[model samples]
Target: MANRLLEVSDLEVAYGDVRALWGVSIHVEAGSVVAIVGANGAGKTTLLRAISGLLPVRRGTIALGGASLAGPAPEAIARMGIAHVPEGRGLFRQMTVLENLELGAFQPKARANMRQALDKAYALFPRLKERAGQKAGSLSGGEQQMLAIARATMSDPKLLILDEPSIGLSPLVVQQMFSLIETLHRQGVTILLVEQNIHQALKIADYAFVLKTGEIAMQGTGAELIADPEIQKAYMGVLEL
Candidate 1:
């Protein structure tokens, strides 16, 4: 049996009677990347928010490491080793590049391991190191995205949840971002990726789930999903020869 690091069972979320996700289940094995691909408003972001405890869950359970994380506070969830890099690169624009990263390690142990984490982050994003004293707002779009991931990783999270890390970047930047994701996977980070770019996302994901109208339309290995005709037409948008 695979080591199930994170398991979401029949999860649902709503906002003032408007449901976003309904009865969705997904699993992430240790040291693997899992992707959730869907159109806008398909609840991909909602799912990551729910997992991070940033959004309330109306039903179902989110379990990690054999414990139920249901109803935990966002901070509580973060301390439990889940880091969420939301859709927007939510950085402290006024803060220096290094300051924004330090905020990610607010927890005691993370703070204690600050030096190690900082070195790791810098190694992963040398550009950030070069701009360590620069204000976050001054960085370009692609640089901000890299900073967002680096900031999130400073916590040394067991599960890294990224919401469209490739969004709003040039094609070249997106390629660089994907390459970084692959590197992170090889370095033993379990990722839950929510991306609108299906083919690129599937290229690195171990498993994938396609969301349509807030529900999982398909679930399979990355290759399996890529080879699936229905999925290709519905999400991938073009036939793969």
Candidate 2:
């Protein structure tokens, strides 16, 4: 059996008096891609926020490699090997691409290996190397997304969490984004992804969870879910004639 790298058990989260997630549970295995798919209001992003410690958990537990992630701040969480590339591709707008990437390795361990990490990042996204000196805000949408993923990799995370990575990109660029994600997985980064592109997400995932109104509505292997008739109609846009 594959070792679980990250686990969320019976999680409940709220914003003030309003509950956003209820009894949500999921796990990502080492070196595997796990996807969460759902409609916009299904609380997918809320789940990511809670896992990354951006939001406080109202109830339940989140563990990383058997260690509880109950009290660490977001930056501290990054140092503990979980990098979250948020939905907006949160780059330092006025800073150069290289500078943004350098900031990603601010943690002690990652800082020591910064040079190797930069080399790897550049090799993965050569376009970034070409735009190394350019301001982050000036790059095209696709390039910015590439920089976001590359920056997250600088931390040498055990698990990478991505939120809507394909949002606002052209279809061609979206395809490239998924391909890069696959490359990252092949290079041994366990991924926990929340994507609106359900078909592509399912295609690349080893296991998947479908969220509805802040709860897991379904769970199965990627192949199993893809072949399920209900999933095909609801998520894959398949219509039986």
Candidate 3:
């Protein structure tokens, strides 16, 4: 049987009167990479925010490892082993690369495993290790985005949620990022990827969900979704590999 690592059921999130997510439901199996793809304002970022506990869930439940995650603070959720690398690469600009990475292990246990995490992060992004002492703000856009993801991985979370990692990155760098995500998947990290880069995301994902206007529009195995004609026309453009 497949181990269900994370589950979100009938999830609803609203900003006062504006409903951003409406009954969004998805599941992540252990050690699997799941992609959530959609266009702008399609609730992709909102879904991540809700799962990370950064935004309030107006209804429904989120469970991680079979435990309820409802009403938890972002920090508390982090401690429960869900690391979120939000949209816009939210790295502390004034801080050094090392300092920014260290913040990922803010929890006591994650802090205790800091050395191991640091080594892993360095291995995943050698550029980060080379620029450890340099300020985060000094790096290029792609490097900054890489730093954000490396920092999140420093926590060694059970689930890594990334939002639009390829945004603002060059094609070459985006390829590298996707390669690293694949490597992480092989190392047993369950991922919930929110991205607009459909082709790249599907290439590395085991399963995929399409979010259209806050609800799940379609879902299937990566290969199945890639083969679907409607998905090809709407989200993936052409069916060419």
Best by lDDT: 2
lDDT of 3 by residue, 12-36 (tens): 9999999988898899999999999
Local error of candidate 1 at residue 197 (angstroms): 0.6
Worst 10 residues of 3 by lDDT: 232-241
**lDDT for each candidate structure:** 0.92, 0.94, 0.91
Runs with alpha carbons beyond 4 Å of true place in candidate 2:
239-241
Residue 17 of candidate 1: its Cα lDDT? 92
Instruction: Give the clash count for model 2.
Output: 0
Q: Residue 37, candidate 3: how far off, in angstroms?
A: 0.5
lDDT of 3: 0.91
State TM-scores per candidate.
0.97, 0.97, 0.97
Model 1 per-residue lDDT at 208? 93
lDDT of 3 at 69: 87
Q: What lDDT tens digits, residue by residue, belong to model 1 across residues 45-95?
A: 989988988888999999988778896899999999999999988999999
Sort the candidates on lDDT, descending order.
2, 1, 3
| Candidate 2, 35-118: lDDT as tens digits | 999998999999999999999999999999988897899878877899999999999999999999999998988899999999
Q: What is the lDDT for 7 in model 3? A: 93
